[model samples]
Target: METSFKIAFISGKLGDVDGVSLEVDKWIEVLTGAGHEVFTIAGLYTNPLQSISSDKQFSLEYLRFDSTLQHHYEKMMFPYLTKHPTHLTSGTRDIIVEEMMVHGKELSEDIFQIIQDNNIDVIIAQNTNAMPMTLLGGIAVYNLLSEYKVATIFHHHDFWWERSRFSQNRIEGLLNKIMPPSDIGSEHVVISSYSAHILSSIKRVIPTVIPNCENFGKAAVLDNYNSHFRSDLGFDKTDILFVQPTRIVPRKRIEDSVRLVGMYGRKYPEIKEKIKFIISLYQGDELDDSYIEVIKNLAKSEDVDLHLISDRVSSVRILNNNGERLYTSRDVLVNADLAIYMPKWEGFGNAFLEAVSCRVPVVVSTYLVYKTDIKSAGFDNLEVRDNYDDEGLLKIPESILIDMHQILNDSEKRIQMTDKNFEIGKREFGFKMLSEKLNTLLDSYSDEIRASRRRLQKSKKSYAV
Candidate 1:
């Protein structure tokens, strides 16, 4: 008989524009396309049911970041954010651990029930074991996996050690254990080679590296639905749209984009009014309102036309609750003239691939992962060194500004560059690669399952004798 497994994707939140959510969506597409039955279990759903049917979707309130218990625990764990206690007392720490165990046990039962009801063959835990955003969820998943023999793949995008905020946490032991259990009957998948190396060094486990990919076969195009994207965002046909297709976060280095745009405006005063640097996504993951304020202040000083259109963008194209026509990031990308992706750090650049898929030219920084994993792919981006000036702004080179001007004004040059990028992106980070990798994983999992079953049957016969 032909082999196919029913897979479940479990995460804190899915169906959103965040890197984890977006990448999970792509995996779901590939999995379902390959005739595998796929289901999603998330703490929250940011969009209406479209990818997965409502019946196949499961939502657990306790798994959400803003759940009563989660929020309380977060404040306690990262007390620097709350500004009350600098550290947790040993007694208080023990109490929190006890509570987590109790709550995790309850959550494990619920998750196991879902597995039993669905007959799920594989569970793809998306970032649940990597980040501490959903601590209890990670604990519960660990509990469930420890008690059961379910085939699992822990898809870790970012680890807790990578972020500074999670550094001074009170739950060190809990994080070391459940955040990513050292010994589990499952495979581990990291998005970049850097992550794989880090995991190997820290946890003594080798992981499969699966970089983020895009559907290059179906590239974004300016359709009737998305044609009005520019006008709706109050831009003219002649306007130069420089899109920062990422969240308003410090790590994204959005301030660099503002500074680059400011330089372009100063260099060419005639086209200054027509230049629009729009950030296409919302403030997400990292909570820093001060960073938004800093960007606004920097833009004002540089005389750059900055616009935040996240309110009108989502994972899917539909009317929001306010009846406003929402555009996906692709809608924003297809209409953009240039994309600014100057991140200080990234697990894997999803927005970079999105821009490449949309046939948009980009100005990218040479972050560590990009230097190691993505840059050698032979992409023709206007490269910026990941260096900072005394003013804490990303140093913009004169050549980058000149190249930006040429690409923006010269239509033939722009087309040639974007077309070349699209071909390279498709060749390197396409959906075909993802499909092939998934096939190999599934095949190995099937073999392992069969061997275990045979062992169980042999043991039963021996017991009877």
Candidate 2:
């Protein structure tokens, strides 16, 4: 019989306009290409409007988590928990446990039934185990995995420990149980060496490092895109598009991007009217209204041509009722003159990878992850430090503009840089590179399965005899 594993890629929200959604879609492409049927078990979805048909061998069930309900529970309960390095009191712990059990029972039942009904061989629990966005969802997945002994691959993108928002919560005990279980019949995957090392050190769980990869082999053709996109956005053909392909979050440091462009525009009077700094995503995490206002004030003061185009962009391409084609984020990257990725923290920095894949020169900030891990790998780009004084800011953009002019002027130099970056990326973050590591992991997983099955058989025989 032909052996094809039925894989359920589970997440909090699978089909949204976010990095996680983009990453999951890429994995589906890889999994489906490898001949495994891919399905999504998500809180929300924005792609492939129809669920997996019953006639098809694969299936995905949507376990919708009500955002309003989650918000209510969090507001009602989270305040009483310890903040910033959250340790819980006995009273709060009891309440958290009660809620986990209540939601876990229903979640576990549904998951178990789905597994049995579909003969699911394994589950790729994406970030749900790492992030406590849905505490009950984690509990449910944890309970089902333990009771059924199902093979699970917990693909951790970011851990709750890495974020400040989850610093103090009443769910520490539950988070410990599920935020990646450290036992034999399962495997774990982390996106970066930094995460892998930290998780192993903290939880004593060895996880395989699978860096997020991009497909650069397929060239990004820019035929009608430039003209069409320019016309759509009301930009002239001569306009210099400086794209900040990230959300308007505090951590993203979008003000720096606006400043970068504004400084450039001011320094180069010849291109003053042509520079446009476009932020492609909507406002994020309303907790930091001050930072949002800072970006606005900075842009206004610097005379930056800022465009927040969140309303127009989405994860998937679609034609509206009026026959307007909505473009994906990839389209934005393809047409960008330069890409800015100046985030304070990133697990793997997929935006950097995307920029390189698009063959665009980038201006990056020296984020901790990049400084410690990526710099040593020998990938070269126009980069700067975090702190930017007035003089320093003025100098940095001038240098970048000169570099972009050179990159545009010198075809040989541009090719050399792109080629070198591409090779380095392929060595580290290419799909095939990850696939090789995954293949070995799968070998180990198969051995684990065989050993487990034999042990169960021996126990059964011994009891029978």
Candidate 3:
């Protein structure tokens, strides 16, 4: 067997229910299984996400790039972003850049110290390079790449230009410069083909497209632990548990799910009575205020049993302070009759893949990534065309309601669809596929790391002299 490599993953915030954190966890698992030592640099890391041995605990503090982490300070500091790109004084803009540069240097120093302490061979930046949620952090990534001799994988989840939440104002210059600036030594990885095309067109840098994947090897079964979810959540055997396994954000088009349930109830009032819509993930909307409230009111108007169960769901399944067993997002998936992922936009379809893995029939809106990267994977689902006007309102499809009702009522159809989708999900997006891609990426690197270390030693000796 080959010797294991040391890989460090750097990110702004982790150990949460966000997609970037989830994907990074998958990468850590795969790399560790392949006998590589995995480590993290982030704003936060939960115990479940960290499996490193006690011996590898050196430089843990250095691993944290604290100031670079995302927080409420961001919207205030860069008010020009997400807003209408209002004009500020030249002094204010300059001060912002100056602060970023100073902080970027400090963060870069910590990264270098971590490399020196841990002898880290490769750096896998998790969603920090492209997105400017924290411009200082993004700039810090550039400084590290330029100043260090380490191998880097800029794993871009999404870019600033792709998101309306980013600024097109004064910081545009800074964003264009270091929000994943072109670096020759470092490798780039995009989650979808759409991003790959755009990166190439805009940045003139082509990258490997490794779609977000799941551990399809693990079968979701009715174990003693997870079997309690349906009853514990107060659902009788008769109630159809329809789950939306995504954050309650505006772009997710969660209103579509509520409206679908409403429309279903109007057609077959009896079936509607048994339908329960549970959003398994947390509510997340920094830009648009009170979308959750709107969703709740809409569900009320439509007379759908919509429950926001994010408080009940967590990244890990553990006992709560009240001695009750806390459930994860997976727990909800296993107990669900159907999953609906109707996002207007997505970096990639993670929740959709999860539904497929859990062997539940799913209904997905044709988000861009799903349309381009995943639709051809041959998974059977209640897929619908992206239905909505400019605003986030749902233009309800009457035809989908009929098919969805038919599918829900039939057990044989559920089995057939779920089995086929699971097989496809396992074949294309499994850990085996991810491992192969990672191995290929690792092979592309030279044995120059050893030589780079020797050069660093010489430079240090001269500096001391």
Candidate 4:
């Protein structure tokens, strides 16, 4: 008989445009399809889990990204890295930790109650276990894992060490201890080999690698509803749309995209006049906004028609106050001619795969993980060596420009390249790949799963009294 268990996906935030939130949905779908009852618990959920889950869902405001605990965490951690190391007094700093503990302990109790109430057999801390962005939520996870006997999986998408801003923080010790505990009861799942190596070297814990994936079965569409998206974004039907479909943050190296379009246009002025560089995502919770002005100025100097259309995109499709349709990134994607995915750093580029899924060619940068894991996937798309000089400028090769021009001018080249990349993407990075990895990982935990089932059985019997 096949094993089916009750699983809970816990995160600080879900049902949002963030990478962690987006990937969590994929995991839920795969697990649900595997005949397991799945649920979601987050601090915020604009769209609840019941929409996709077979089990009950829970959302606590404090577990969300903008929770009080997160604010306290920012207050406690940011000062050390900033010019204001003395921003908060010792007393004030102590008070912030106190608030985190107060809220964290409360969250722990709530989670414990939920587990007891529902008899959940497995817990999947989706990014919440590995990130200290939600200090209280991290603590709550650690506390629960330490005390409870439930089998847990830590889907660590990105670690604090990977980001520069998190380097010199006040809560390093606490972050190290609980952000991802050294517990033998839980298994760690990281997206990249680099992350798995870090976990091994630092925590002495091995991890399972499950690269982010897409549902290639659900084909992208260019329906009449989104037919006017080009016009809405001030682009003519004849214009070539070179889309930068990522959040407008520093690490995205969106400036490189501006440069790519600028140089491409400079080389081919006839098409430059017809090319529009569209950024189809929002400026996420970036610590600095100075990068925005820098990019805007750069785009102006290059004469690239850079359009920021984050306002028109959302996690769910809804109408604005003007009663206009709020289209998703998919809507923006199928209408695109090309995608620019030149992130200086990425946990993994969902948009890259989305572009591949939409049969759109993407100019993907060779970020470390892409080189370590994804580069050898035999994708037929533009490749830029992730090289930077002493001046911190991306050294994009001239060959990449020639290739882009060729693909843009020739429809056959675009179709053939996108088709080959889509086939490769579907073979290696699709849902079938994820489901197989997940099944094997879960099967390895057969002993613990059986043990967990017995524990729940005992608990249920006692509660009946």
Candidate 5:
């Protein structure tokens, strides 16, 4: 009979710069604002918690990506990282599957305890069933949902099949069963229409599309604390700061950003020396240091002043143990002259929304989701074709370079373009839109629960007669 419900958000990691973490934060904000009790359960916490109380937060070590069980299964399933044999023997495969069941059961028990303690009414599994980053975690959630009648919503951002690295795995059977189990009595949510179409084709179940949203009401500005971001990051006052606010992952195609800057420098040699390309976020979710090296070498060859300042960036501003100031991602965006977001693929563009919300001009690649779901929103940005050259770098259009030059050099043009973009972005992807969609989804679930209870009562009375 209660109007509000206690909700629990479960994920592999939370309070970080990744798209999933940022989206989860926005969901928590909207849910709490709607008078619902929210709780967080994550395997790892990279940043401090802001919205959820400490008493309501739960951390499980076995569910972490770096846990011994996860590493063991990953190496066995996807053996590209290590020198181990690519194909597992049938007997060895069976043993690994048995171990998975054992560990998964333990994890499910632990998770159920938290659910019972908090009297949670719904569980929002954040990317757990979509990606195999934490294999046991996915199985555990599936098992928990199978044994109990706890309402759930699988908020899938990306699926394992989308990534080439997870394509040739030895655990196909297990992945098919629990990576995203179709039989679970829960709602499904995807970030884009493309993802929803794909999920329907694969799982035969239609998903509700919920595009990622931003808090446009509290736009970042050049405040007193963030005014010194440039000086603190060692950038000269006259330098043109072009920020790549994404992780150093392969799909991001950061080399393309470096190449664009290099081409822009050649076109206008006068300002080449004053250009600074800054990659604000850290390396990606996967284990790959060679890609960072590749970017560094390419930057050197292109003669770009590339700076990796992830050490001083966090979800929120704080001081490190060494007494150095750590700036939030908003601080990096507020001071940027232009944002370069040329990812080859993205579930949805969180960095794009962040830049637009901050009133910064963006140079975005026309990725699939961008073309399908976002471009029609009428945001004015310097667009790059997603086509690539034989060298595996994005093909930068000449017109993009010309537009970039104008936006970077002319103050009035920059202000007009960015202001227009901010209004369009806020109108399309603001918190109010998300809050409305979420409320509707929750209301439907509440109706289903009442219908289910009525059916149970009718069946019990007939059986007693």
Candidate 6:
């Protein structure tokens, strides 16, 4: 690894409850630890960047997508963006193509400024290039990388081809150019094998798999965290803690967690009142606000002890003036009796991986990534399908109790499961493993650039003679 290079991480929104933001932060930790300078440029960021750098690190010159002409382009193309096979009238398709041509030029300029200002030796573009949510953002990145000989690693979390929202767009020209590893001087990296396979089918670019992982500090539980955590949250030590460490987003299908808890209470009447389902984060309907209302109604009707603790927890641990010690997401995971992760769709389930890493049993939905990638790694848990399974809903909490008893009563079983998972996670998602893959990709890019420069120098010398 070249320790002296300045690496820049670019994203549409690099901070918040989203998976991309969380994964980017983990990359920052790994990359910075290896002695490379790191910078962030995003439309949104909640993390403090004082440690990253004061001068070189920059945020979006314009933060909102609605501000740019790109938003209007996507808005007008929505009718043609549907995945269902339908013939768009020629007039509509022509209008959409014309708009794309105009926005493409404006987008190119934004990207050029970001690259020049940061003096970015290499770019780690996070998910923006993969998903066309900001279509012009993808176009901008593609244009800049194609023109400048900058080394880039497109950290693809989800591809436009996977999602239905983008499948029918009339702008195939733009999508083909911007999506994945095509038409850009970049290496492609997907978070799971399934994404890598799908990307390979759509684009000639075969993505390197660099799955997500929890940080070093997140692995071990703090010794006294639970005592203070319970006290602060007004729960007794014996309260059954069911933690859902994800945002309140519709795709997350959080109602499933409520149903799981309610069904568990009905089956195991003994621990009914003792169970507390805590949602440790919030994502307030940034896309569509209706889902938030639906979740609130579901929580209320189910009578589940659901707590949204976003206000209480920060990225760093601190104490309030009243001497109440605040906690991070790690502290919540450390104290959890069981972690419910039932996302209907996920790029990869980082929460499930973190739960197993922290020695907590998990109740996970069999999302594509888990079914194909994580499940094969030997994770045993309550696995549900896309929708609620009546049997799983009724039996999973009891399963948690059985596992809890084994963890507390049988030392050997606990050790076997935890040690097995740790080994599996390290093999698949550990820092040591991922860093080796990352540096290998960067080295190949470095070699190509060096070769091109040498050839250019030789040509100039011959001309002079």
Candidate that would win on lDDT: 5
Tens-digit lDDT string for candidate 3 (1-465): 244677888876666777887898888888899888887776555434655664543332222434433333354345644444345578976776686578678877777677766667777887777876555567667887787666778999988776665653456777787777776777889999999999998888889988999998886666898888878778898888899999988778888888887887899886778989999888642445578888989999989998877777778778777877778777789899889888888999889888888888888888888989998988777878876677757666788887888888788988899999989999999999999998877776535444445555664566553
lDDT of 2 by residue, 1-465 (tens): 333556777776766666677677667766666776766667666555233443432222323444654554555446532233344578876885686578766776767566555556677787877876666677767775687576778889889877776756666666777887776678899988889889999889899987777766654546664336667877777777888888777778777677777777776778788888888776632246666688888999999988877766777667667776566666777778778888867887877887788777778888877877677778878787766576534225467767766775587887788778778876777778756776677666875544434444554456553
In model 4, which regions exceed 4 Å deviation? Answer: 49-55, 80-83, 86-95, 456-465
- Distance (Å) between predicted and true CA of 431, model 1? 0.6
The RMSD of every model to the true structure, in order and in angstroms, is 3.1, 4.7, 2.8, 2.2, 3.5, 5.1
Candidate 6 lDDT, 1-465, residue by residue in tens: 333556778777764546777677777877788777788777655655434665655665333344455555655565543234455687977876776655654655665555555555777788768777666666666755676555677898877766666675767666776776485456888888988888878787877888887654447675766447888888888888889988777778788788777777676677789988899877732354677687778888887777888776655566767776777776788788778898878888877777777777677878878888888877667566554466533224456545544564476876677677777776777777767876777676776544434443454456554
Q: TM per model? A: 0.95, 0.86, 0.92, 0.94, 0.95, 0.82
Q: Give Cα-based local distance difference scores for all models.
A: 0.87, 0.70, 0.76, 0.82, 0.87, 0.70
Off by over 4 Å in 3: 1-3, 46-50, 54-73, 80-87, 285-288, 390-392, 447-465
Return whichever of 4 and 6 wins on lDDT: 4
Candidate ordering by lDDT (highest first): 5, 1, 4, 3, 2, 6
Clashing pairs in 6: none
**lDDT for position 373 in model 2:** 66
TM-score of 1: 0.95
lDDT of 4 by residue, 220-338 (tens): 77888788788776779998999988888899999999999999999888777898899988876555678889999999999989888888887777788888778778788989988
- How many Å off is the CA of 119 in candidate 3? 0.6
For candidate 4, the per-residue lDDT at 382 reads 90
The residue-by-residue lDDT of candidate 1 on 406-440, one tens digit each, is: 99889999899999999989888999999998888
Off by over 4 Å in 5: 83-87, 448-465
Please give, for residues 327-382, the per-residue lDDT of candidate 5 as tens digits.
87888999999999999999999999999999899999999999999999998899
